[model samples]
Target: SIKLVLKMLDRQMAVIDKNIDGMLKEHFAEKLALFKDFKGVGPCMQAALMGALPELGQLTHAQIGKLVGVAPLNADSGRHKGKRITWGGRATVRTTLYMAALSAIRYNPVIKTFYERLLANGKLKKVALVACMHKMLTIMNAIVKSGIPWNPEHQNVSKNA
Candidate 1:
C-alpha cells in the first residue's frame, strides 16, 4: 500500500512537471531559455526562480541577494563586532537556490571554482555554498538585465559594486 501511494505521488509530480514545462514554453520561453543556459538550473529551479523572482532583471545584484535571503547581514552592536548572517526573505526561493547551488558547485565551472577558492581561504562549507548562491543569483540577474545568455567570458560587474 505504501509503495502504491508513493508511485501515485510520483506520477502526480511528473504530471505537474510536464504542465510547468508547457507553461514556461508558452509564456516565459525567453526567460526559460536564458535560465536553461545556466549549467545547474534545472526545470524545477527555473520554475521556482521565475515564479518567485519576477524582478530578476531589474534589481541590482545586492537587491536580488537580499530578496532571496542570501545576502549577509551584520549582527554587530556598537563596538562588539558580530558574524555576518543571512536572514529574512523568501524561504522557498532560498531553499530552491540552496539546492541549485549544490548542483552548480558540481557542474558549473564558475561556481565550482568560487567554492573551491572559498574553501581554500578557510571558509566553512555552508558559508561557501551561500556565497556561491549569491554569486549565481548575481550572474542570473546580470544576464537577464543585459538580455544575454550565459557567457563564460563575461564577468559580473555588479558583483564588484
Candidate 2:
C-alpha cells in the first residue's frame, strides 16, 4: 500500500514539473532565453528567479543581494565595529543560488578564477562561495536589466564583486 502511494506521489510530481516547464517556456520564453548563454544558471535557477525573486531586474545589485540574504550586514554601533553577518531573506532563492554558485565555481570562467583568487588570498571556502553567489546574482541582474545576453563585461557590477 505504501509503495503504491509513493509511486502515485512521484507521478503527480512529474506531471507538475512538466506543467511548470511548459508554462515557463510559453509565457516566460523571452525571460528564459536570457539565461541561455549564462553558465551555472539552469532551468531550476531560472524558475527560482522568476518565481521567488520577481523583483530581479528592477532592483539594484545591493538590493538584490539583500533580497537573497547574501549581503553581509555589519553589526556596528557608535564606536564598536562589529562583524558583518548575513541573515534573513528569501531562503528558497538563496539556497538555489548556493547550489548554482557551487556549479559556477567549477564551470564559469569568471567565477572560477574569482573563487580561486579568493582562496589564494586566504579567504575561507564558505566566504568565497558566498561572494561568488553575490557575483552571480549581480551578473544576472545586469543581464536581465539590460536585456542583453550574458557576457564577461556584465561581471563588473561593483568593485567588490
Q: RMSD for all candidates, in order, please.
A: 3.3, 3.6
- Model 1 lDDT tens row, 35-152: 7668888887888888888998999999999988999999999999999999988888889999999999998888999999999999999999999999999998888898888866
* lDDT winner: 2
Candidate 1 regions with alpha-carbon error over 4 angstroms: 1-3, 155-161
Per-residue lDDT tens digits for candidate 2, residues 1-161, read: 99999999999999999998998898778877888977899988988998899898999999999989999899999999998888888999999999999999999889999999999999999999999999999989988899988875554775548
| lDDT, each prediction | 0.89, 0.90
Q: If scored against the real structure, what TM-score would every candidate get?
A: 0.90, 0.90
Off by over 4 Å in 2: 152-161
Q: After aligning candidate 1 to the native by TM-score, how far in Å is the CA of 86 from where it should be?
A: 0.5
List pairs with backbone clashes in candidate 2: none
